[model samples]
Target: MSDTESNSSNRQTGIATALQHPQPFEESTIFDEYREIMTRSHEQQRQIYSEFKAFTDDVASWVKAASQFDNFRSRKRIKTRLEWIKAKHGEIEGVRREVVTCVEAVRAALSMLGGITRSLKGFSGIVKDEFDGGNDSDLQEPRSVDCAGPNQACAK
Candidate 1:
């Protein structure tokens, strides 16, 4: 096969593999295999968040150190330091963006899980309510998160 055709074939294979193993959605079975996958994803996402936070903390420290470098120096060294500092800041910013994206994806999965859980609860509620004819309070008010400042405290 020609180089182009070979590349195309490789791309097709990659696409096929990606579609074959797409991210897991919530399953109905009690022993859902995908639950483990979801849990792993959650853990991986949390790790990314932790790493991003550490990167941000390091950037904060670097910025504090840079602020102390007010003494006049050679133009070359000054330019090099400025460039290095900017690059570090940019790297931290990129990680922050990745963290946001990863967090949002994990949050979306959690939301889907929440929906499935609620549906299951509703079904169980109907069955329980039928047997005892009792009112159900499983559906409570949604908790609100305060994402205003650095610390996100969930409002009760």
Candidate 2:
């Protein structure tokens, strides 16, 4: 399709912007940052999941401590059980701190994603041509390809 028609179709369909898409072999620094941002986000996800698992494990330990405390009390071994309970409670505090850290990590990841999205809205981004055929004077004309027809560019 013509450039104008292609741009119009893209806008109408809301499928994408008028920004020229790069072919697979093309590379741009912005795209590199995009990849890095996504990579960090994935890593952060893994860390968060690991932290959540640790938190769950800590919670299970605390539950087990509580159950043991009740049994120990019934057996009149309350003093030993009390000391263990105090230590387990301290671990719960550590779990709380880990949760806070994970939340901060998630927030940071989201902020990075947002920043990258804003960066994508600039130069290597949507252009006036998307809205209207603007300043295409610099664009090269579409050349006839070496199609296997008789009137091909490479007649040899």
Candidate 3:
């Protein structure tokens, strides 16, 4: 569909018009629903990610404590048990590495939420840009939200 058609209602077309006249930062229920969902999903993911990080950190501390115990424990004639402890230590290290990888992946997933927001905001901006079709430097401008001020907008 043409930008014009996509951006505005085709009043003369006699079909139920889906488009509304585009305005800067104008809200849409569809976009609002999406933004709400994305925002909630992002927050949920962040909480999960935080919990995972805390779990990993706790595991790391446990591993450290275990190592300390192994260091101070007196050597005895229980060769089999000692070997088992050594093997378990290696297993713990492997699990720790896996947890770290998982944490990193979750962080990346969370970061993509921000990317999605940017893309949606850009999609809206691009639609607006069609009318002016001039330098898009303003599109790059950072918006600030000073709570004390009358205007509170998040910068792009």
TM-scores of the models, in the order given: 0.28, 0.30, 0.31
Alpha-carbon lDDT, every model: 0.65, 0.64, 0.62
Local accuracy of candidate 1 as per-residue lDDT tens digits, 38-85? 999999999999999999999999987776664434666889999999
Q: Pick the TM-score winner.
A: 3
lDDT of 3 by residue, 36-130 (tens): 99999999999999999999999999999998888666454367688999999999999999977876676567555332222223112321111
Give the alpha carbon lDDT tens digit for every residue of 39-137 in model 2: 999999999999999999999999999999989777777777888999999999999899778767765675553322222232232311111124455
Worst 10 residues of 1 by lDDT: 122-131
All candidates in order of TM-score, best leading: 3, 2, 1
* lDDT winner: 1
* Runs off by more than 4 Å, candidate 1: 1-73, 115-156
**Regions more than 4 Å wrong, model 3:** 1-27, 75-156
